[model samples]
Target: MSTDKKRFSADGPAPRQRFWKEAGVQETADGFTITLDGKPVRLPGGNPLCVTARPLAEALAAEWAAAGLDDPKGRFTPADLPLTRIAGTKIERVRPEREHIIATLADYGAHDLLCYRAETEGPLTVRQAEEWQPWLDWLNERHGITLRVTHGMMPIKQPEPALQRLRTLLATRNDADLAALGVAVPALGSLVLGLALADGAITPAQAVAAASVDERVQMERWGEDAAILDRIAAMNEDVTDAARFMELGRG
Candidate 1:
């Protein structure tokens, strides 16, 4: 499979403003990544379900474009999209670009479409890891998708030294404290917050609780009171494992 991705950067010339159409389907390690606009967003690999869903997605995308739902950026929300009934499940997607469709697929338990083509790959960026974090959480917590984030099972089960370091950072109100631990407050908190947010919308309080030890840890640190940390850990097991998003499961 061969394909291409097209895009118009915000700083590009006027003639370069046009969106590139879908072109190739190249063979990827896990499966063939559908090429659109030259960029290859990962498509499901190896699973027959993912293999079969390709044509259907493409055909549906064209229909969406015809219906005026495909914006220049290749994103268009429609009142209703097509649905294909598979043997035991129904395949439905939010029509248009890669991200939304992949998200939709994950929401439905379509695991095949979510792999990153591990065999033929590129460096996974921090930003890409961030994007995939929520989905990982969803898969783990709700669907029981056990993935690795560090040396063992993901989403560190104990905060331990990391938690102690994080609390120290909060105590001093210093960025250096966070840097010393290898992550900033916001970034570290964001990962924990992402797990707490899995059930629904996230709140700053939840992020704060997960990021820090607990409200009472400052003035009163007790072994029994460690349950607060336990609660936070139960919600999100990882403390030192930033890269292991699979622990969070799918979302």
Candidate 2:
């Protein structure tokens, strides 16, 4: 396939490419590889677009096949092929910028979700402490990283040793998991949730619920309007997608 015809690009949006008529997977020496129109798909850089996991390769091939066969008005968007998009990011972006991705995600630890609390003593504060403190305690017990919690929005600086410990843990991951972290950390606004998801300590649903605990409390105190409900739905989808990507990326 021509580079211009590729549906997803690493840097930004691209013009719509012609969708293939068929898709399948090839068992290559490297691993399971996706094939479009009976030929192996190539990345924009001309490298073979390959996946190491069979389930992921099948999912990617299925996405391409669905894209090709389902578009009459050419309505197939990047959102329709999240697996392929994430795979592209893993190969083209994350692999090349592993250290930068690690550093950036690790920096989220300094101001993680657990570090910030509601200002006043209310249901929100109690809920925040109840929902968030366990994860903080977990980190303390498991990793010896004692993060300080503060009431209010002001940034509290975490200890340098804790930050370095997190940076070391993030550095140990391979490209695919790191790429998943790049999405998960920002999506949930919590490095602890991302690490929990990465280490199989929590499910995506639990992560989403924990990440939105404040919002959930607000909804309970007042009432959830359509806008907040819609946002929660979207966030759930994004977090679930990242979680699935992490799972499939695992061999």
Each model's total of backbone clashes: 31, 0
Off by over 4 Å in 1: 1-16, 23-27, 37-189, 198-251
After TM-score superposition, the amount by which residue 177's alpha carbon in candidate 2 deviates from its true location, in angstroms, is 0.8
Cα deviation of 247 in candidate 1 (Å)? Answer: 12
Q: What is the lDDT, from 0 to 100, of the residue 11 in candidate 2? A: 58
Highest lDDT: give the candidate number.
Answer: 2
Candidate 1, overall lDDT?
0.32
Q: What local distance difference test score does each model get?
A: 0.32, 0.81
TM-score of 2: 0.88
Off by over 4 Å in 2: 1-18, 68-72
Model 1 TM-score is 0.21
lDDT per residue as tens, model 1, 1-251: 11112222334322212244553444545433434455553323322222223443353334323432234444422211211111002112211232443333222222211222223223332323444455556545663444334321123332344333323323332111122112212233342333333333444354434344323343253445565655555334332222121111111
Would you list the clashing residue pairs of candidate 2?
Answer: none
Per-candidate TM-score against the hidden true structure: 0.21, 0.88
